[model samples]
Target: MRKVIGIGETVLDIIFKDNQPVGAVPGGSVFNAMISLGRCGVASTMLTDTGRDRIGDQVVSFLSDNGVCADYVQRFAHGQSPVSLAFLDEANNAQYMFYRDCKVDRQDINIPDLHADDIVLIGSYYALDPAVRQQVVALLDQARAAGAIIYYDINFRPSHRTDVMKVTPNLLDNLDYADIVRGSVDDFEVLYRKQDPETIYKAEISFYCKRFICTRGAQPAVVLADGGVVGEYPVDTTDTVSTIGAGDNFNAGFIYGLLRQGITRDHLDRGLTQQQWDGLIADALAFAAESCKSIYNYISVDFGNNKQLPNHI
Candidate 1:
């Protein structure tokens, strides 16, 4: 079976509502997706770094409990693990305040051996950070050479808006490496100052990648493919408890759908049929919907264990 390899940051998220702490979970843009995939019984690995402190211990333990391989995780002895305070608004959306300790050496880990058709999920500021750019690019190069499907999520946050110009080159570099580019309206608004899906796709994304997925919170997700194929899938309605990892879980669901349907890097160049695209998008929406009903950062363990892809695909 092809595995999912996620390269990103890992931080412990302290979720708060109404000025009180509600829950805490290990989360990162790609880490949440990997954990969800692992819970769904997919073979997954996380490539990240953490300190040797208690928070790091919790992070490593969480990954192991979720079935994500921790072999590639670099444990640094000199720094403290990062933490993020996630304050949920009335709309269930999150605003974050991060606490981190810097180390001169970061993301110092051996890139695991990748095989053809393996899915590589990478994004967030971790991929754009100047400190780790060379290593990230090297891994992407190797994955591309191995015929792995590379998915890039532009999880840009408003906090980094000031450095958008400095990060734009790295962002474009990641786009060049991606087979599928997934970004939200907020991410584009911060990166390109554009929110319209078609405009963003045609003017910015299409030049670097041929396949694009634009997600709008509580709205429909728009998918654009080669040859002018465009598809839209509406988000499922749910009584959302917290929207922390909704997008990450959606990514997990789409990747899970791809694996279930046996879609691979070899088939990507040919593009997916309308049915295939719809099925994938629907699965993504389902996962996202399921996650929003809880305060946890990923799909509940029970849901992931019992979730099944549609039989038609």
Candidate 2:
């Protein structure tokens, strides 16, 4: 079976409602997606590091519990495991504050050997951080050499806004190497000072990567692809208990859609028909909608066990 591999950070999210911390869960951008894929019966593996503390133990154990392979996780004792404070507002959107204690010297993780049709996930500050850039780039190189698909989620959080200029080169390198790029409007706004999907794709993304997906909070998502094809799809606006990890699960569902459709590198390069894109978008929305119904960072186990492809899709 083809596998999905993710390289990113691992943090314990402390979700706060009003002024009190109510729950804690393990999450990272790609980590959250991997967990969902694992639950959905996909082969999921992750490359990340955390301190050898109780928090890190919980993270590793959580991955195993969720069916994600944790063999490549590096546990060091240089510092404490990362923690994130996510404060919820009136609308259940989170305001985040992160605490990470990692040294520049301790991020040595082995790049996975790749195979054709495998999917590699990479993005966020972890992929751009110079400390891990060489390893991340090496993995990307291997993925390309092995004919694997590279999915880049530009999950640029507000915390890294100040470093946008400094990391532009890294960001562009990632975009150039990606087969598909997904980002929220907020991410592009922070990276390029642009919001319109068409404008952002034409000005910033199309040159480096043509398949660009732009999402806005609770709004329709816009997809721009090769050959001047443009698609704007309605999103699920069902009542959300918490908006955390909604995007991650969307990525998972999209990947699952790709797998279920047997859309490989050849199909992507040739271009997907509008109906194919609709199926993918529907799958993405379904996963995201299911995730929003709870506080968990991934789809509920029951939901995962019973997930069905959108009827029309």
Off by over 4 Å in 2: 102-104, 308-313
TM-scores of all predicted structures:
0.97, 0.96
lDDT of each: 0.89, 0.87
**Cα TM-score of candidate 1:** 0.97
Q: Tell me the tens digit of each residue's lDDT in model 1 across 62-115.
A: 999998999889998788989999999999899999998865377556888998
Model 1 misses residue 258 by how many Å?
0.7
Give the per-residue lDDT of model 2 (tens digit) for 36-135: 8888778879999888889899999999998889999998867888999998888888899998774525666786678888899987788898788888
For each of the candidates, the C-alpha root-mean-square deviation to the true structure, in angstroms, is 2.1, 2.6
Question: How many residue pairs clash (N, CA or C atoms closer than 3 angstroms) in each of the candidate models, in the order given?
Answer: 0, 0
